[model samples]
Target: MFWSAEADTSAVLLAQMPVVLPAAANLYSALREPAAREDEDGTHFLFEAGGQTIRIARLAGVPPEIPLAAFVPLDADGFDRMEGIGRLLRALQGRTIPDDHRLTPQQKRRHRHMLQATDGRMNGATYRDIAGVIFGVDRVASEHWKTSALRDATTALVKDGLAMIAGGYRMLLRHRRRS
Candidate 1:
């Protein structure tokens, strides 16, 4: 689940972008299955278009019926915001949204393992048990449990997964940046 600020990376803020006025204002009218949620900051709309979920947020004062402008900030997340908006625009234009390249194959595998390990731990499974399930029971049995690399990997997965559950999952929406 995403918190308010973290969700900004995924949700398009219509109030921030320069208004496309006149004809463009009717663009939102064609969106289907819009689910609106009212919050202190604004009203958020979730639309399903082109088999993708499009999140749009309008500031508190903006009328719910009127589609507001969306702005991309000049910050670390500028590229991420632009990418998200690009996907939304493509979906709006009846084009296919490309796959997200943020997480590569290895990262995807590790994330999947992390969630699996976390779930196993939550269900009272031991690290050895988790490793067995992930790396195959036969492979896990071939190595000494106390000093095996697979054992350490299983532990790390559970640790990272717990961190994600503690709100670190928000980072998934961001692009990696090196200092």
Candidate 2:
């Protein structure tokens, strides 16, 4: 379900559209590229294309009618791209889109650190505790630890970890073809 921040009508319109579960799944799978970021609610997706950022979210419950002429306000190019996506979904029907991709060595390392940070956070560890575990206690307690590069890095790691679990995990699989 796509909506504008300023309007509730779009949400209402989306809710009324017939539920095409496979299309929704395929749409999400197609959208969840390496760059995509999902909101904490697990419904919204944010990504960039052609240097423009895009966001789309799913509606919760189905409504009665989909209003004709309801349009999602996007730039012309963006609108065209969205139309293309709709066409692709119509063409594929219920067929699934392949989304597997291999994690690079760098990604693997970052993912590991992210998992560690996430685990620590879930276990009630403070940022300092997590930083100590990953970056060394001495380093975390140093004068530079306050407003330091290490602190910033740790915060970024936690945020990335949360984003991954939120929706990025779907795109972490090894792809059949190499880029």
Candidate 3:
């Protein structure tokens, strides 16, 4: 699930979204892509002007090679997108999604380390160092010094990244590598 920080919105990213490289993404380069659908036959997601795509099957352990039977149309809205996303997932449970292009272990680790480490922690500061390195403009002059800086900073640090939010923050810092 993805949260719209500014919009206070929570939604899951469809498995079939057009992601850059090998990750998942919306086909139209958008999370909420405008697609055609139908409640009767199934849902339809239009990737291109005339290319209407449907969820044939999900690729997980074993990739589903079949294409959707036909284009099923539906309403275009959060509720609709949400419902459609749900149906697609339900129908695709346990399927082997082709995430052949996901990040390498080292790359993901680096990304995590970057998000977890901040400039302050290295100096062994307190409260001001709460945000670690990613946060804290300057330990001495941090605007949040007087406020609940540490608490809020910790939240933001832990809340960094798509999977962090999508996975419901269940994943802990497995390891911290100094970059």
Best-fitting candidate, scored by TM-score: 1
Would you give me the overall lDDT of model 1? 0.76
lDDT of each: 0.76, 0.52, 0.36
TM-score versus the correct structure, for each prediction: 0.81, 0.40, 0.25
Of 1 and 3, the candidate ranking higher by TM-score: 1
Encode model 1's per-residue lDDT on 31-118: one tens digit a residue.
Answer: 5534567788786777666667766666677664566466677887777777778887888778889876768999999999999999
lDDT of 3 at 176: 24
| TM-score leaderboard ranking | 1, 2, 3
lDDT of 3: 0.36
User: Residue 137 in candidate 3 has what lDDT?
Assistant: 48
If ranked by lDDT, best first, what sequence of candidates would result?
1, 2, 3
Candidate 1: residue pairs that collide: 14-69, 16-71, 17-70, 17-71
- Give the worst 10-residue stretch by lDDT in candidate 2: 6-15
Assess the local accuracy of residue 105 in candidate 3 as a C-alpha lDDT between 0 and 100: 82
**28 in model 3: Cα distance from truth in Å?**
20
